[model samples]
Target: MKIDARSTARTLAEIGKWRGVLLYGDDLGLIRERAAQCVRQIADSLDDPFRVALLDQEQHGRVEEEVGALSLIGGRRVVWVRDAQDALLPRVTSALAIDSDTVLVIEAPGLASRAKLRSALEAHPKIASIGCYPEEGRTLIASLSDLFRDASVAVDREALFWLSSVLGADRAAVRSEVEKLVLYAGEGGKLSLDDVQDCIGDSANATLDDATTAAMAGDRAVADIALERALADGLSPIALARACLSLMTRLQRVLDWMDEGKSRQEAIKLLKPPVFFKKMDSFTKALERWDGAGLRRACEAVQGFELACKQTGCPDLALSRRLIAQLCLGPRSFLR
Candidate 1:
């Protein structure tokens, strides 16, 4: 049966009933977290590599062969096929029919509503199809409430708003930060707005936002400080670079929309993955200072830096720093 996001807890609670699970979603982060949950249900330790067998694109096609091979050990086994596609349905169906102690998990990108694989999984007696979509608006609020309820924690009303404002659609991040908050509060303690701010606030988002805004506005000192803070927080050079590129892409799209006669608010509304309400104004201001030319230069710089990181003997960190510095200090004449 197909599982909804709200039913995630209930499904997790009764996961043992299903023999095979197919987790596919738009949110790669949530898909991964659910896959891990399934693995943890069967695995004692991730350190034991044998506990789970991970199959990539090439190996995933051989599912029937892999499952048909006898396992010397009678213990339960989990075969996880990553980046799953429709091509594996036949083998996956065969694997599920073996009536063995093995569970097959297929993780893929978003599947169509009438997809054959998804429909087959839903109709199959022993398999559970899980949809891992990002929570938004009311769904997000409900999910948050469910999480806190499960965590046995009480959250203040204002605290909920603040926490939600800072959080994106990353379920694992939300759970991790909440777990931290729960640990900090101890038993029977209530979570306040201050607690949310101090424990669950999104420092990473702030750092990236600051760095991107500063860079776009040509504020060298602020950009330098924000980039430094990000590095200190263990953000990888490549990841930081991607963050910059991603922001540029968003701003450029908004600019494109505005050039086509859409207003700032309308352009913001047109954004895919819709900007958080709290960050709408920030993005609008960014749209003002961000233009196509700056975006092209930044993209080239980010691409070159990524290539350098991939090639051995390249100073990845230094190259990353230089890219950010140049974007902030160069003669781009930011539209602001």
Candidate 2:
């Protein structure tokens, strides 16, 4: 069965009717989330050692073996394969070919549309295939509204739009943000755009985002506060450096768009995994300090800093802070 990602909840409602399920897509959080949801539908609990089996790429060949075995407690077995690839198609096909109560779920990330494994499973009458791409804006907003309604939080359309734009990439992040918003608003409280922005942008995750933008914008005071808070909360220095690198890459793409004669708004409209609404203005300002060479320099600095963190006896935390501080100065000021 070819099930649409948007229809996963409805499909999962009937999960027991399917012999096999293949969950693959770009949105890893969604893929894993839906996979777990399906498992919970078919099984009593994931924690039961005798009833559930967790497999990965390294344990590829054993899925069929585990499913075929007789359970100690005689319960229907649940076999989950993570990071599955096309090579496992034969096993999946053979396993699903049997009429059994055992459930098989595979998490295959980045499987091509034309991949033989996916096609093979889709062709099977008993198998269900779903692509868990990032949720569309409307779908995301609707889900957010549903959550808000359940929590008795009154949400305005503008606030929903703000959330939709900010959290299109990761469902887990979006869900977490919404929960915080509901809590922040309390029961039966009206939510506005400012409330959404205040709650989402002031989160722990947002602290890292603020640090990334402030570092790029060369705002010494803001950078210090953001970095200090993030570190105090146990965020590692290398991890923070990597976030800066990812942000820089996105800024570079925006720069490329600008160079091609697109207006800033037009360029931003084309970015994938979008710049969050709260950080959009800061990100735009930060890009003004760099061109192609400068962006390249920033990437190089982050890469070098990553290597230093791996070196023997390196003062990684302190070194990372220094490297990011230098990057705050702009690309032409690259540390020699």
Q: Candidate 2 clashing pairs? A: none
Per-model TM-score, in order, reads 0.57, 0.60
CA error at residue 99 for candidate 1, angstroms: 3.5
Query: Relative to the unseen true structure, what is the C-alpha lDDT of residue 167 in candidate 1, on a scale of 0 to 100?
Result: 54
lDDT at 164 for candidate 1? 56
Candidate 1 residue-wise lDDT, 239-333, digit = tens: 55655676778778888888899987888787655665555555665666656787776677777776667555878768767876777664363
Best by lDDT: 2
- The whole-model C-alpha lDDT of candidate 2 against the native structure comes to 0.75
Model 2, residue 138: distance off in Å is 1.5
Candidate 1 is scored at a TM of: 0.57
Off by over 4 Å in 2: 72-75, 149-153, 185-190, 203-336
Q: Write the per-residue lDDT of candidate 2 for residues 160-272, one digit (tens) a residue.
A: 86666544245566676778888899999998888777877655443556677888888777777877776675555555565677678788888899999999889887876
Clashes of each: 0, 0
